[model samples]
Each structure stands twice: as C-alpha cells, then as structure tokens.
Target chain A: MAILKTENLNYVYSQGTPFEKTAVRNVNLEIEKGEFVGIIGHTGSGKSTLIQHFNGLLRPSSGKIYLDGKDIWADKSQIRQVRFRVGLVFQYPEYQIFEETVYRDIAFGPKNMGLSEQETDRRVRATAQRVGIPESMLEKSPFELSGGEKRRVAIAGVMAMEPEVLILDEPTAGLDPKGRELILNQIKEYHKTMGCTVLLVSHSMEDVARYASRLLVMNRAEVFCFDSTAEVFKRSAEIEKIGLSVPQITRVFNILREKGIDIADDVYTVKYAKEKILEYLKSGGKLQ
Target chain B: MIKDITLGQYFPGNSVVHRMDARFKLVITMLFIVMLFIGSNTISLEVGFVFTAMAYLCSSIPVKLIAKSLKPILPILAFTTILNLFMITSGMPLFQWKFIAITDEAVETSVFMIVRILLLIAGTSLLTYTTSPVALTDAIERLLSPLKRFKLPVSELAMMMTIALRFIPTLIEETDKIMSAQKARGADMDGGKIKDKVKAVIPIIIPLFVSAVRRAGELATAMECRCYRGGEGRTRMRQLKSGAADYVSLGITIFFLAAVIFINAID
Candidate 1:
C-alpha cells in the first residue's frame, strides 16, 4: 500500500484577507513504502506547504490526505496518532531544540508518545547513535554543541519517535561541505537499516540526483513532475525551463551530447558520468 | 492563531491624511485627545464629535478595521458604562435599588463617556492607519532631536522602537511555525485541561524564545557588519521635511481645539 497519498489538495494561505494567497493547489501525490522520494522546488514554490500536510501540521483547504489508505483527518480525535506515524523534520530544525540536555531533547517526542521511561531512554540512545551523535555528548547541553551536532540532535529527536515515514525539509541547509556529506551519509544509513520511506526536500539538484529513487518536482505551487529519477531527468529541458538549475553534471553531459559526442543522456550524478565516460572511451567513441 | 492582531498596523493609502507629515499627525492626535477631555458638556462634546467625524471622512480607512480594534476592549467599555450608571446619584433617579441607582444624569454621563472614549480612539487610530511605522519613527527622532542637547539618546531610542515594531510580525510568524512543529510531534495543544494546555504551550514557547534570541544575535551582528556605531553622525536616505500639507493639518486641528474650547466656555 502507498504509505502516503494526497488527492486534489489545495491550500489557501491567510484566507479572507488582503494578503490571501493560494500556496498550493490540485496536488496529487503518492509515496510507496520504503521509497526515497526527493522533493525539489524553488523558494516559495509551495514545497514546504505541501509536505506540512502529510503530518497534519496543516489542514488542506479542499482535499484528502490518506496515510496507509486511511484518511489522516477522518477522525480528528486521533490525528496525533497520524503525526506519530508520519514524522516531519522542519527546515533548520535545530531551532526547535530546547531541552537542557541532548538526551532529554531527543526523548521529548517519545515522552509525548507516552512511552515508559525505560522505553523512552532506549529509543533516545539508539536514535542518537543512529544519527552519529556520540553517547558522551548526550548529557551535554544542545546549545553547547556545534551547529551540525545540534542539528543531529534535533533530527534524532524526531527519529526517536520512530515514525514509519520520515520527511525532512532542507535538513542539510547551511552546513559546510564535510558536514553536509556527514549528515547525508548518516541519513542514508538510517534509511537503509530502518527500511522506512523518506522524503528529502532540498534545493541542491546534485544532492537530490545522488540519493532519491523517485523525484517529485514542484513549480509555482503545482506538482510539475512525479516519476523515477531516470525518467524525470529524461525531461531535463522541461525541468530547466521552470528555472530550476539541473545538476552541473547533467548540464556538462548535455553540452557533450550537443557537440555530437554520442553519450547517454541520463547522466545526473558524477559517479554515473565518470563510468559512462570511461565506458565510452573503451568502446572507441571519440570526441567530435 | 496570533495573526488577528491589527494594532499599530499601517494601512497604505494616498489620501490627504496619509500624505500629511507624520510629525504633524502625531501632534494633532495628541491635541485632539486634550480637546476631547476639555469638552465636558453636551454642546462641547457635540463639537468634538463633529470634528472627529470630519477627520475620519478625510482618512478614507474602512470603519470595519476600527471595529475590529475595538473588539478587544469591549469588556472595558461595558464595565465603564455599568459603573457610571449606578455610581452617580446626583440627578433625579429613574430606577432605584437599595444602594445602586440609575439616574437621568447617570445615563447621560455614560453616553457622553462612551462617545468621548470611542472618538478618542478613532482619532488616534486614524494617525496610525495613515502613517507607516518607519515614517512615524523618523518623525519622532526629528521631533526629539532637541533633547540631544541634554545628552538624551533620542535617535537611538527611536531606532530601537522602530526595530521592535519591525520584528513583531516576524516573531509572531516564528511562534506560529514553532507551534506547528511541536504539534507535529504529537504535542496535544488543543482539547485538554487547563494544566495540560499550559504544558503543551511550554514546548512552543521555549522554541520560540530560543529562535527569537538567535535572531536578535544575528541582527546585531549584521548591523555591526554594516558599521553601525551610533546615530550622532548618521545620515538618512529619506529626510523628514515639513511642507504646506503639514501646516494645513496643524491649522485644522488647532481650529478644532479652539472651536471645542469656545463651545465649552459658552456652556
């Protein structure tokens, strides 16, 4: 079954005011279990608004969001149960960390879930370790940690809830190069070991190209494209037309193909580009 | 849920009231309040009300927004009315209870008080609706510039007020976002006991406070990067200069005051 689904979704912000705006409209999407869905959009393209609905942080103006084939808002009394099943890690989530210690901070979600003390402790430690936070640092204040470490604690807070579907909005924003790679690799490991669906909202096309199996592209509050990574990249021209910067490697390959180099067109990642170039040279395909 | 606040909000327009200098508008609003209090009798209050109505007609702002602003103060208005209706016993009694009584003079006094209070708020809200906060602050800094002779930090105080006003909406937006983030973590923010409601608010408030402090630090650093030292030698991009519009507004408001005072003296 699809882990999450939204049909005919519409959201009007600041309704009945002069600043009223339709942030999202007619958004139809589905995420299967264990699928790594990448969300890509320009700023103010409604990517944030669309994902907020998955966890019931926002109610759609007109539509339905079904989690595991059950409407999330069907019974308002049990909506918090839906929030537990679908975790949403907001952008720059470190700002949400407020507990005195990292351990207590990570346990906040589990405690809210009414877990026993021992169970909450177990989940907090396990999640902290899974997110690459050192066990010794768990007793220290989150404010005392570096920016990247604090972000890990914030992520672990949500991970401790152990939601079946994890959604991160710009989790890697404002991090240095090495820090970015470290967090992304840890998240990749977590996804593999937990076998849960993940939705990573990011601005970097290269990052999305490297990890996501399926891609969801938004433009001007509409779902422009929703397909596999390979299939979406096939319409690279259309993606670029919406003013999204396709990955640098994809642009480089596009230039090569234009000059009669006769290389395959689905080169989005640097690793794939390197393999294809070496294979082309081995197969006697010469530069024009 | 905090977005309903319309206090101190500036409505954009190009009417004569909006075009008047912010300094003149502030002075006129102050003088108008003094005039309203000076008009103690019915005839003087009638003059004050007519002048305020004329100002409102020139402002072009919708009365619906004014009513929204009054909504939060309805309890106070009602309480004032009740206190005046029973507390005063000088005139002939219309209805008498053991100690509480409603007299003709008391009823008239309540109506007069309510009308004066409503007109006072309307006149002041008109000034805020016409002038943007930035313009108002700039005017204030200029108006208070003479205080610098006594070593008072007038410009700095005005700048602080302006910055504070500028961030009210930002802080409110941050609060809304933090509330949603905590609620997504299964924090029961609604349909709970009083203590439970307070407990749910802790998660939201702590994060909002942290973010606000962080933003303040960032803003200070940004200002320092731009080499902001003090307002002593600082120049502005837009200078506040008085013109014919300013003088005309001053004259009109003074005329309003003179007319109210004359009516009160005759009464």
Candidate 2:
C-alpha cells in the first residue's frame, strides 16, 4: 500500500518575484509502505523541496500530497498530526539541536507529540542506543559533542517521535565513511524492526546501492526515473546524461564489458560484484 | 515565507538613480525627508509628492514594489486619517455627530499627512532600491569620516553595518530552514494560545540563536585567518566618488527643497 504519495505536485520558490524558480514540477510519486527507497539527484534537482512536501513542511504550489490515502493538507489545523506521522530530518540537522543535553534534545519531538514524560524518556533512550549515542553522553550538552556524535543525536531527535514514515535528506552528509556506515546501518536496522517506510535522499550512489531496495532519480525538477535498484542502474548511460552516475562497481562492470570481457552488467554493489566475479571464474568463463 | 519582506532589498538596475553616487543619494534622501516636513499646506506637500513620484520613475523600480513597501504602513495610514479626521475642527464642519466631527480642514490636514508620509517612505525606499548595501555602508563611512577625529570609530561602525547587511539573507535562510526542521518535529509555531505560541517560538529561536553564534565564530576565525585586523589601513575595491551626474542630481534635489520652502513661505 502506498503510505506517502504526491499527485502532480509542483512547488515554486519566491513566486511572482524576479528570483522566482520552479523547484519541483508536476511530480507524481508513490512510496509504498515499509519500503526502503533511496532518492538520488544532482544538487538543486528539488530533492530537498520534494521531501519537505511529504511531511507537510512545504505546501505544494499545485496538486496534492496524500498520506495514507488522505490528503495531508485537507485539514490545515491537523497538519501537526501529519508531521508526527511523517518525520523529516533535514540536512546538517546538528545545527538544529539546542537543548541543554542530548537526552532533552532527542526527547523534544516526543514531547511535542504530547507523550508522557516517562514514555518520552523511554523512546529517547531507545533511539539514542539505536543511533549509537552512549548512555553517558546523554547528559552532556549536544553542542559539546563531536560533529558525528552531534549528528547522531539530531537524527535520534526525530527518531524518538517514531513516525510511520521517516524521510531523511542527506543524512550521511559531511560524515566520514565509518560514521556514514554506522548511521546507514542503524537506519537499515530501524526499518527492519519498525516496518515503517524509509526514504533516504543521498548524493552518494554507492551508499544507496548497498541499501535501498528501490531508487527514485530526479533531474531538472522532474522525476527522471523511478524503479528497482538494479533497473535504475541498468540505465547508467541515461543517468549519466543528466549529471548523475551509477555505482563505481557497476561502472567497472560496464567498462570490463566494453573491453571485450563478458561480465555481469547488473553488478551494482561491491559485494554483488565480488560474488559475480568469483562465480564466473569458477564456471571457467573466459574473456572474449 | 520570509521572503515577502521588501524593505531594504536592493533591485539591481542601470537607471540614473542606480548610477548616482551613494553618498549623494544618502544626503538627497535626508534633504527629501526634511522637505516633506518643511511643507505645511496641501499644495506644498503635493509638490513634494510630485518630486518623489518623479524620483521613483527615474529609479525604474517597479510600482508594485513601492506598493508592497507601503502595505506595512497601511495601519498607520488609517490611524492617522481617522485621528486627523475627528480631531481637527478648525474649518467648516462637513459632518457632525454626537461626539464626532469631520471638518473641511480635517480632510485637508489628513490628506496632507497621508501625502507627506507616503512621500517620505517612497523617497527613502527609492534610495535603498537603487543602491546596494555595500555602497551604502561605504558612503556612510566616507560621510562620517569627519567624525572620526572625535574617536567615534566611524569606519568600524560602517564595517559592522556591512557585515550585518551581508548576513541578513543568510540569517533569513537559516531561520527558514531551522523553522522547517522544528516544524517537522511537530513544533507548533502557528495557531495556539498566546502563551503556547510564545513557547512554540522557543524551539525555533533557540536553534536560530545557536546557529547564528556558530556562524559568527566561524566568520571571525575566517577573518582572522585572512589577516583582517580592523577597518584601519583598509582600502576598498570601488572607491566612492562624486561625479558630475551626482552634482546635477544634488542640484535638482536642492531645487525641489527650495520649492517646498518657497511654498511654505508663501502659505
């Protein structure tokens, strides 16, 4: 079932001014429930604007956004309810952390939802653990933590709300490889355990290829393609035409094929490419 | 949503007003304000109005932008109109009720006040619309350089103004982002009791404050790394100069001011 959807959605920034720009245009998208979908695009392709619409942070200039078969904007007064159901973590979320301590910051979302103090505390601790924030650091000021730790706490702030659909815009941005992997693994585990829809907006092709089951590609304020991970990677030439690239491993396979070697062209992730190479060699597959 | 603010926003253009020296424009805008108050009668204010309209046309800024800048003052306009209409009872009574009176002089005085206020806003807004903030501060620094002998730190003050103006759009964009981030977390910034509304702002304000301080620190560090000590011994890429056009513009502005003074003297 489609849990979050946008129908013919359009958004324009600073309309009626000289600086006016159409950030998102006539985008019709459907995100199924409990699916791990990765959204990829070059900068200024409306990835940020599109996700803001999903959680009611931005109202579309035209068309509608439906959350769980109901128009989220149908009742403006109840928009906050929609927000709690669809949590959005923005880029550089660490800058939004302002509470005296990590625990209070993570509990902010739950408290806004009017949860009891005890329940809010419980969720805060659980989310902290999930995001790899230690129990000892929970009492420290969020501003004092390292960049990676602060980022995890900020992510935990939204996770504590336990929304039905979580949309994170560039969650792994400005993080080291290990930090990125740690956060991505936590998100993957959260999706597995919570069974909630997850939409990860990213600029890195390898990160999404390793995790997301489906991919949505955007270009020039429009949906370029939306399909399974392997299917999207298959159109690497088309993706490249629009200033985006497929995974390095997939490009390597494509290059090997072009060099007169027969290799699996669908290899997108490093692990899958390794398995395919070993299997082909054991089967006595020879270069052309 | 915060982009609706039109005040102090510069619109790039190549009109005569845009090309005029900023220091000259600043002084002329001041003279224009003074001229507005010097005119006592409706005819005098009308002259001031005509001059402002001509300046607006010369600036080439869209009429809609002027209307937008006037929108925020609508309440003041209405309040003054009502106040003047009911308070001034010197001339023939146009309308009279139990405790309210509207006279011919009231009508004239209200029109004069409205015209004077509108002209004041339009004249100043034209200056900002045509001149960039950087040039404005540079002009201010040069104009106030005479006061530096009294240890007024004129250059430093102008440098502060320049930095403040530079960060306005950045700070506005940051505030918008932070508001959205908090709103997504269910922070109710709109539609609540008075106390609840104030409380809701805490989330947004606290984050905005934190980020603003961080940005300031980063800016200071960057400046230090670039060997910025102070405004002392600093040279500008584009020096403020008064050309022949500036002198002509100043002459025309003085002529208008003299016209207003002549009208006041005749009245």
Q: DockQ values for all predictions?
A: 0.74, 0.82
By TM-score, who's the top model here? 2
Estimate, for each residue in B1-267, the C-alpha lDDT of model 1 and write its tens digit.
678877688999998888888888888888999999999898888877888788878888887878877767778789999999988988999998788789999999999999898888777888888899999999889889999999999989998999999999898888887877887777888877999998888888888888878889999999999999989799999777778988987898899789888887787
Give the local distance difference test score of model 2: 0.91
Q: Report the C-alpha lDDT of model 1 over A100-163, residue by residue, as the tens digit.
A: 9999999989999999999999999899888898899999999999999989998898889999
Candidate 1: docking tier: medium
lDDT of 1 at B44: 80
Off by over 4 Å in 2: none
Report the error of model 2 at residue A218, Å. 0.9
The lDDT per prediction is: 0.89, 0.91
Give the TM-score, chain B only, in order for the candidates.
0.95, 0.97
